[model samples]
Target: MLPIFLKTLPFFAIIALGWFAARIRFFPPVATEWLTKFVFYFALSAMLFRFSAALDLTSLWDPAFVMAYLGGSLTVWLIGMAVARARGLSLPEMAMEAHCCVIGNTGFLGVPMLVVLLGPQAVGPVLMVLIVDLLVFSTLITLIISGSGRGPIGWRTVAPLLKGLVGNPMIISMAAGLVWAWLRLPLPDPLVEFLDLLGAAATPGALFAIGASLVARSASRIGPAIWLSFAKLTLHPLAVGIAAFGIFGVQPFAAGVMVAAAALPVAGNVYILAQHFNVAMQRVSTTILISTAASIVTIPFVIHWITGGLP
Candidate 1:
């Protein structure tokens, strides 16, 4: 555990540095926004594409892995909803809280960190987890929120959902890369070098962006924030671990990666959804802030246990 913690320290340190910079007015909010856009649209997309292009779909796709991750995520999602309902939250608010419980920062944090820690093989499982979260759970929340409000689920809601999925750069890049791999197309040397150069920026840029963004989030609504954080850093991973290991019997390596991914903090995008819907924005923001701070310790412990002190 100590060794794993040591290995992870620099990542958190970078985050702290970003926080300090932002707090001190060195990295401004505007700069953080642009940095996030660059990483999301360019650097991270390049990385995903390169990784996806290198591997065939057969090696990447696993029905059992998908089922295990979905089952575990849904378990936590339901628990979150129940807790929110018990607290007398509205349907949309309950959906938002449930979103916080299950959607980890897989795109920004998990992909770069897990692949580096667990190896290239972790890419497939991590991507699968990201896909499940994006496709299934994200869509579910949108539908729930839409249906709960003004009228029935009509073309208005479904159209934007479909558009968002289609327009998402991560999904597009991954799909393009997979198609390239399926056709057995060799990446030109120049293109490979270009992608390598761009993707190299993803890790540090993303970590820094996360830290800078957290500067604006205050620890308001402590009780619910802590509950959501606990759900994310503890319950989420535990449920996923059980499903992957005990129920679905996923391959050990993939299962470990999935568990680690599950252990990540509440995604930044969850706050975006809350803000968009004008529901529980403070709670979501607080959860992201708390969960991320907590994950600095929780993540290393999880990695140490999953690797059995091997690495």
Candidate 2:
């Protein structure tokens, strides 16, 4: 247990450093934004593309694993929506709130954390979770939020969704890599080296940006954000654990990885999406901060449980 915790320490420690830097205004305010953009567009996509390219195409397909993950997340999202409705949140706000409940920082946090905790093999499963969270759950939220706006939800709403999906570098890279893998195309030495450099930066850079984002003003209403954080850090993983180990009967190691991925902090993308839709921005942003900071404690226990730690 101590060994697992020690191994996981550096990732969160880097995040804390980023938070401290931001709080101190160590770098220009806008620098973190540029770092985030570089991560989303360049480093993260490059890592995904390179991993997918090298992986066996057969290893990338795991329908049962994917479904189990989505099932747990959808359940949590629905619960969030219900809670939002009880609180009299508007439709778009409810949608965004529900999204914040489920779509975690799987790409930036889960991928690197799991890679450190588990190994390189964790990449495929983590990437699969990323794809589903972005494509399926995010698309669903967009449609709901669009419908909640003044205008009717029509082909116009879907056009932007399609456009955004097409323009997303991560999706594009994943597609290209899958195609390369299918064809068994070999990457040139120089290209592989370049990608390796980019991939190496993805983890630390992302953690830094996440910490900086936390320095901004968060939602004032701490109560709801706390509950949402609880749901994200606790309930979400419990649901995933049941689905993976009981329902799906996955192998022990794979199931453990699935639960750990599910246990990751709420995604930074939630705040981006909330800001874009202009709904529940403060609340969702605060949720990200709380869930992330809390994960430093919660995640260690989760890893120990998954690994069968003894007293």
Candidate 3:
């Protein structure tokens, strides 16, 4: 247990450093935006592209794996919605807070942590989580948030979503990589090296950006924030475990991958979505901050269990 905790400490340390740097204004204020842009536009995309491009087509098409993750995510989201509505939240507030329960920081945090803990094999399931989030959870949350009180849903409501999905760098990179993998295309050595270099920087850069984002944000409404964090850190992974181990009977490693990915903190995208729709910014930011800080303790234990530490 001590060893596992020590191993996971550095990931949190990188984030802590970022938070401290932001608090001190170590880099220019604009540097945060630039780092985010680089991770979103370049490093993350490159990392996904390289992994997806090389992924086995069979691995990409796992129905059992998909069912385990997507089903678990939907189940948790519905539960969150029920709790939010019971709390007397407005429709938009319910949507925004519920969104945090389902979607997670998969790209930046999940991918890097899983890759470090489980290595390259982790990417396939993580990619599946990303697809489900972008295609299903993200789209559904958008409709709920944007469509609320505005009128019946229509093309106008969905058009922006489609456009954003189409233009999303991570989605585009993954799709291209899938196509390339399907075609069994070979990349030139120079391009491969270039992508490798960018991919190498993605994990640390992303962790740092997350830490920095937390520095300015305060965890408001602590009770609700902690509940939402529990929904994410505990319930989400529990659902995935049931689906993967009991229902899907996925292999241990793959099951572990799905569980760990599900255990990730609320996504930074939740903040972006809240800001875009102008709702629940404080709650969303607080959730991100608290859940991320808590995961440092929770994840190592979760990983240890999945790796046979738990009886």
Best-matching candidate per lDDT: 1
- The TM-score of candidate 2 is 0.95
Residue-wise C-alpha lDDT for candidate 1, range 164-260, written one tens digit per residue: 8999999999999889999999999999999999999999999999999999999899999999999999999999999999999999989999999
Q: In terms of TM-score, which candidate is strongest?
A: 1
Model 2, residue 166: distance off in Å is 1.2
How does each model score on TM-score?
A: 0.98, 0.95, 0.97
lDDT of 3 by residue, 145-262 (tens): 7788899999999999999999999999999999999999998899899999999889899999988888767868888889899999999999989998999887777888889888
- Regions more than 4 Å wrong, model 2: 149-152, 309-311
True lDDT of residue 235, candidate 1:
95
In lDDT terms, how accurate is model 1? Answer: 0.93
What lDDT would each prediction earn against the true structure?
Answer: 0.93, 0.85, 0.88
Model 1 stretches with alpha carbons more than 4 Å out:
309-311
Candidate 1 has a TM-score of 0.98
Q: Sorted by TM-score, highest first, which candidate order results? A: 1, 3, 2
lDDT of candidate 2 over 1-311, digit per residue (tens):
78778878899899999999999999556989999999889998888899889888786787778878888888888999999999998899888878877877888888777877777877787778888887999899989988775587889889999999999888998889989999999999999999989988999999999888889847676898898889888888899888877887765666688788888888888888888888888888888888998898889989889777312
Return the clash pairs for model 3, or none: none
